[model samples]
Target chain A: MVVRVSTAPFDPGAETNAFLAAGRGAGAAVTFTGVVRSSPDDPIIALTLECYPELAINQLASSIDQATSRFGLLAATVIHRYGRLTPGEPIVHVMTLAPHREAAFKGAEFLMDYLKTDAPFWKQETGPDGTHWVEAKAEDDAAKARWE
Target chain B: MKILYFAWLRERLNRGEEEVSPPSDVATVADLIDWLASRDEAFALATQKRSLIKAAVDEKLVAHTAPVAGARVVALFPPMTGG
Candidate 1:
């Protein structure tokens, strides 16, 4: 298990290749990357992800532990970035390895679902007009509830 | 104990964290919020929508009713919107 909380930009391709290469017994590997959304109609200049690093690390570690046990994952890596980011930048990356494809996919999904609603990070978007904190979506909460 | 705030709450409160010492009767997280709201109108306004606020005690997430007696640090923030 690996969890990274960083402010510096990271290369998702490198991360994916490294994770895939490090796999030993697992036959299935899944990497999910979440990128900042850039809309033409509602263009954002920058996005700020604010977090409590120590608390975030603790929460993420526990979440990874839960996903690993629940899905029987062989290996997992989660990298979440905070601070200022531009449109199209990668924000979060999740990688999971398991013996079967189903477990690998589900484990990554579980981590994303948990991070979307419960993790200790808040997103704020700065657009042409102004900066506003992103509101939590009911749909995201519902998606996480499905796992329960 | 130390208290921290985040998001709009941090802006609304005009600061991120502060030291606090509540009365002995302010036993629970809900009680602490009530006590804080009573002491400052900005806090009251910031927490007007109480259900939207989430809290953590010593880096561990907990509900509003969680006790605050033994906590060394308490943080309050809005719902997460990160993936």
Candidate 2:
């Protein structure tokens, strides 16, 4: 397992290739990437992500560990970015490998669900009007709850 | 103990982290929050919306009623929104 929280933008293609290369024996691999999307009503110019780096990493690692055990994953990777980013930029990437496709898919989904609510990252959107912190959605909490 | 704030709480409080030595009466996360809310207008205003607040004691998520007798760090923030 590999987990990274970085401020620098990453190449998703490169990251995917690296994860796939490392999982030499795994028969199935699943990847998910989250990108910043502009709101139609209130167009956002950029999004700022703030986090306690050590805490975020630790939480993500533990979540990954749970996913590995529950889904029987052979390998997993999560890369999340912090700091300011413009719309359309990638925010996170998750990849999972398992002997079969079901485990790989479920593992990737599980990691994402946990990361959405459990990670200690906060997002603020800067738009035409001004900067405002993004409110947490009830839907997100519900999404994470299903895995429990 | 070190007290950390994130997201709107940090912005509203106008700072991120601080070392606080709460009175002995502040024995739980709820108590600490009440004490903090009494410290400054910023804290008072920021903590007014209790439903939005979430906390971690010593880097582990805990309930507001959780004890904080020996905790070295406490973090307060809004619900997470990451993926």
Encode model 1's per-residue lDDT on A46-148: one tens digit a residue. 9999998888888888889999999999999999999999988999999999999999999999999998987899999999999999999999999999999
Weakest 10 consecutive residues of candidate 2 chain A by summed lDDT: A50-59
Scored by DockQ, the top model is: 1
TM-score of each: 0.98, 0.95
Clashing pairs in 1: none
Cα error, residue A109 of model 1, in Å, equals 0.4
Q: Top TM-score: which candidate number?
A: 1
The per-prediction CA RMSD against the true structure, in angstroms, equals 0.8, 1.3
A1-148 in candidate 2: lDDT tens per residue?
A: 9999999999999999999898898899999999999978868899999987878888999999999999999999999999999988999999999999999999999899899988999998899989988888888889889988
Q: Give the per-residue lDDT of model 2 (tens digit) for B1-83.
A: 99999988988888989998998888898899999988888898889988788999988888899999889999999999876
lDDT of 1 by residue, B18-76 (tens): 99999999999999999999999999998999999999999998999999997999999
Least accurate 10 contiguous residues by lDDT in model 1 chain A? A18-27
Clashes per candidate (backbone, < 3 Å): 0, 0
